[model samples]
Target: MTGCLDDLDITMVEEGFTTKDLLETLLKEASQRGSREAFFVADLGDVVKKHLRLLKALPRVKPFYALKCNRSKEVVHLLAGLGVGFGCAKKPELALVKSAGVPVDRIICTGPCKQMSHIRYAASQGVQLMTFDNEVELGKVAKSHPSARMILSLATDESRSSGCPSVRFGATLKSCRQLLETAKDMNVEVVGVSFHIGSGCTDPQMFTQSIADARLVFEMGAELGYKMHLLDIGGGFPGAEEAKGRFEEATNVVNSALDLYFPEGCGVEIIAELGRYYVDSAFTFMINIVAKKEVPLDQPGSDDDDPGGKKSFVYHLNDGVYGSFSSVIFNNTCPVPILHKKLSPDSPLYSSSLWGPTGDGLDRIAEGMDLPELHVGDWLIFETMGAYTGPASSSLSGAQPSRIHYAMSRVAWQAVQLLQGKLLPPEEEDQECTCAPLSCGWEITDTLCVTPVFAPASIM
Candidate 1:
């Protein structure tokens, strides 16, 4: 509703249509062309659902979607239109969000270690909010972006219990005084406190402890003559529906903690950096099996038996760890494969491993899979691939990332529009239609705001 929706090339689908239907259509087209090209189908509707969940569950805390998770312009635009703030770690991400017509106030320049040029660029663009964790970072910010409103990045002491000090980021509690003093001496305005309890944290007590620590820091900032009005409890909520219970539990913990630590009418603005929670389950990655091999391991002292029966299969897919499945290497994500073709109810399962087309030993995507025999050109759909896969994908060794197709059901489109206060009077359902180029202007064909309208039917 805030940004222009006419520019987005979204495949408007019927209410009953799902991403699987769109993926099936594309897979059929690919098979017909004798092409084993891999691609992704992103449900923009899912993103809207996730955003609404955040607003409904944690009404007090605003969510700033980390662009590091997925910088897909379609997502950025949709979120912008929905009035979600952005957390950008670099200048390019800032530019990406800004290109979607996001205001500077809605964009916070994040990360402790930032380039001078990036700071200068953000300052030049009238971006005011930023975060820092050290005296050196404070000095840099004071020199580069004097008018910058800074949030101190506080590090949690979880490692004190876990006995792993090396896994932590941000400034320690003992050093908070020195950092605040240095910021004051330099005339740098330290506006608030922020902390990240790492990604994928499962314990709600960790968030509780972190929130308590932030309360201490906020008190410290106030004593040092800082306003300390903002508190950013960084994100680690699960992404997929299977983990919905955990997400709800975590939000409940966060809300209770906020009430106890920085209650309502406390004059402190609250926000969270939500990365995986927003996009991970929205995009489904589909890759074709390019090659397969029977792998055998030696059986010692098996004089009467053949080792062939114990052999496992290694199937190479079009995209792998280096490309669309980079989360395998970075986040240790285990991608579950969904066969495009159905097998018999009693179909025997075989031990299988999956690798990439590049043939690099390090390019393995997944292993310990019990899948039926798959051949060349067969497809495997990997759901929840939207988190860190797309933006971090590499073309290393000619491993091209899958082309992305964006879509949303007509009902979902209407819901988001209505939620954003941009939906017009009631209208008929959108007919079966594909995507149009973003450069083309769209107008209303019926009573709705969108006109009745890809590679695989849509592009964003």
Candidate 2:
């Protein structure tokens, strides 16, 4: 945590310091400097809170922060320091967590279809906790990383949860036995069962069936003489303020299922690959409007949600689906931007469509946003933009990814340091999934120490 935190320029702040407050301060500085680049203000304290809350909710399960989500180095380091394991999908990801001082035993190679080189790399590093859903993958691991402790991935019925038709990944329940048998035949060690209910899963009951399916797989592994000691109920937990209720409901559902199937002291180590649940609400993105266009309602080939709607406004932002907003294309995310400053409550609203700076036609950010008519120099604020936004980028045209200014309260930094290697007990008797709220007070004489985000030339 020292080296990672040393290289990272995190701002040390007092209690009650928020992301918006930092953004407001930066906005004025940007005005004088004429800097229009998109950026993020990430509240590291919120991330710390979520990790503590997770331990309080599911005491039996270990959390492996998935690298594919966000993959911000600072976030990874913070979580690593707090004892969250890493779920690496590729070679570079493995290097990342390893560089952060994550032990090979604490990391899981979660990618199913791994390349031969990647497998060798993982093996060379002694990262033996790999996942495979099919015999081919198992065979590859047998030949390459024979010492691997593989987790058999069981497919969940994700149609109801993912909203889209099943985008399949894991092995089906019927296929589980055959896969386990094959692992035995190939002399590959199958030590656990894993499943992802799917990203953005709405139904918590979906996890119930997956847990049941995993239990059956565990039995099958036992039948095959495989020592199954791990059960991974993979990620789908909610993170937004609105999704707090759903997250709590999911906590109850998952905890009950684990209790019923993999009870306490069951000799099974449970782990979860949580990505978005830890970072979504902690980050706020600010994109500058670079260009604007006004098209008459009668114009042909113009995009409009309301037919016969008045003039349509199109605004081009500095970052788009090609870069930081890749979630727009991949996750079907429609980002509704919040104006940096609400200048007028009575301002006329118009049919506005937001597009990223990329010249491609598919680089649209949001369509049919009922926004007050804004100008080229105005700024747009977007929250819940942390997960899947940064990691999915294609980096079209070799443009630099936006910067993130990390901040945490002194209280939070100390709190996290104290709880680094231990899980704190639930303070509230009735609240099952919540951590004891931080009792913090601001010191009037405290000074804010920020990591340098702006270059000296830019500031001047």
Point to the candidate with the largest lDDT: 2
Which 10-residue window of candidate 2 scores lowest in summed lDDT? Answer: 451-460
TM value for model 1: 0.87
Consecutive 10-residue window with the lowest summed lDDT within model 1: 451-460
Q: lDDT value for candidate 2?
A: 0.79
lDDT per residue as tens, model 2, 255-330: 9999998899889999999998999888889999999998775553245563335667888999888888888878
Superposed Cα deviation of residue 183, candidate 2 (Å)? 0.9
lDDT of 1 by residue, 134-219 (tens): 77788888889999999888887554332233125688878888889989999999888888765556576788988998998888
lDDT of 1: 0.78
Models 1 onward score TM values of 0.87, 0.89
Model 2 vs truth, CA RMSD? 6.7
Q: How far off is residue 138 in model 1, in Å?
A: 1.3
Model 1, position 266: C-alpha lDDT score: 96
